[model samples]
Target: MRFATWAGGAGVVSDAGLHPLPSGVSVLDLVCSGLPAALEAGSSALAGPPVPLASVRLLAPLTPPTVRDYVAFEEHVEGVRKSIDGVGGVPPEWYRAPTFYFTNPYAVVGPFDDVPVPPGSERFDFELEVALVVGRDGTSLAPGDVDIFGYTIMNDWSARDLQAREMKVGLGPAKGKDSATTLGPWLVTADELEPYRDADGFLALDLRVSVNDTLVGQDLLSNMGWPFEELVAYASRGTWVRAGDVLGSGTCGNGGCLAELWGRGHDVPPLVPGDVVEMTVEGIGTIRNRVVSGVDLPPVQAARPRPRIRRRDV
Candidate 1:
């Protein structure tokens, strides 16, 4: 079943419209409680009168506990390596395992919310990705042990100029990425995606992105180098992955972001205020956001060098 959260409350999406869940039950609560319980709750809620989808203001499906985004597409890595690092090939270390980085959970916004150009940023961009919400807590998990509650479309909004500078410091995509990340429209349960699973067990869903109503890029979810299960497993290694934690399938290949196109010598313009960016994952749903101007502030003070501690001989 597909579920959504709106200003009123959480609801199950259907042909009739949205079937509101119990007053206090939220999408995050259902996700933490597990699928069987959510199914039971949804079953009971279906008896109530449905609300029209267009009438309510939709919000982000849930506020994730944490967000881990992985680069699961080699094509995306290859495409952006040059532009981001001024290098032309995928790094050898990337093949050893599915790698990811932590992004700010607090920065998440709804499918149709307005995303501001991060303060001090100019080259704003959007990344088309698929993200899965964890159903339960687990540590040191294997691929088969991953538990997923559902899937949603993710737009890992980027501030390319800021990201490039941060990467040079060998530490972050921090402030550059912490500005905003988009998830929602709604979340679709794993069972609903069964029909789209390929022979190799990967979801073969089509993904597309558009800027201001013009199609910019499209690719297949099947193009991912590592499946969601594996990415989850890697994320679980030596750490706990709990319910409501979101893990993204990274950027899709072919033309997931403007950086990738720029690396290939394409002259796509950076996102500007008033530009509407939309991303769609076939089985899931579409998430559209409008870019808006951010609050301008003066540059932060630079870090000062600290005196090194003298080591005493043992």
Candidate 2:
């Protein structure tokens, strides 16, 4: 079943619809793993007020008490390698279990929201990713320890210029990722999306993105280096994954602004103010965010033009 939290009147995303839960409950709550149970229950509950999907502002399904975005896509790894490392290959360690980094939970915004482009960012780009929302709270979970509550499309909006600047310093992806991250439309429960994963255990959703009607990034879900479960186990090795936490499948191969536009031309146009970005991963949903330029506050007057009385004194 599909589950959604949306803002109809206030900032809160009310429980509109979902699948059946373990018990008979209408409102879905964050549990250990995904919201499968809550979704199940919500789906089975008596119909609530019909809040049209179009009218509500969809937030990240889960508040993600915490967030860990993993760089587990081989395509992205290889692409960056070829461009930066000048080799068309991946590092030996990149094939290991899904590895991740903490993304600022506070920086997350809902669907159809305006993502503020960092000031001076000339190469602002987009990443099409799928994020898992942990429903249960646990520590050191074994494989299959947690069940997925659902999946959502994520736009890991990137600042390529800042990224290049920081990577040269060898610090990390900081500054490369800040200011804004987008997720949602709604949380598609596991049951609804189970058919999309192939027998190889890799997801098989059709993921694609476009900027102002121009197709840029594209990929099949079947290509992820590590599945969600492995990432969960690897991530939870020393840390605990609590309910409402988000785990993302890093950028896809051939995905993102840099990889797609690579060699397109030396005069590649960078994202500027007023650009509209859209991402759609099959089964999840579409996320649309507009880029807005950062501006300075009100200008200060120069002492009222040095006071006209100065002319009278002269």
TM-score, cand. 1 vs. native: 0.96
**Relative to the unseen true structure, what is the C-alpha lDDT of residue 157 in candidate 1, on a scale of 0 to 100?**
93
Residue 18 error, candidate 1, Å: 1.3
Number of clashing residue pairs in every model? Answer: 0, 22
For model 2, residues 1-314, the per-residue Cα lDDT tens digits are: 45555543212123443322233222236344246445444544424344545554666654567778888787787676555435567778877567677778788888788887776676787778888877666678886786666778887888776777677777657767876788786776677788887898888999888888787778887788878888777777887876667888888876465644453223447677888888888877788888888644444334444444635544
Give lDDT for model 2: 0.69
TM-score of each: 0.96, 0.82
- For residue 149, what is the lDDT in candidate 2? 68
Report the error of model 2 at residue 166, Å: 2.1
Query: Least accurate stretch of 10 residues (summed lDDT) in model 1?
Result: 304-313
Could you give candidate 1's per-residue lDDT for residues 161-238 as a string of tens digits? Answer: 999999999988888789999999999999999899898889999999999999998999988888899988888889
TM-score of 2: 0.82
Q: Whose lDDT is greatest here?
A: 1
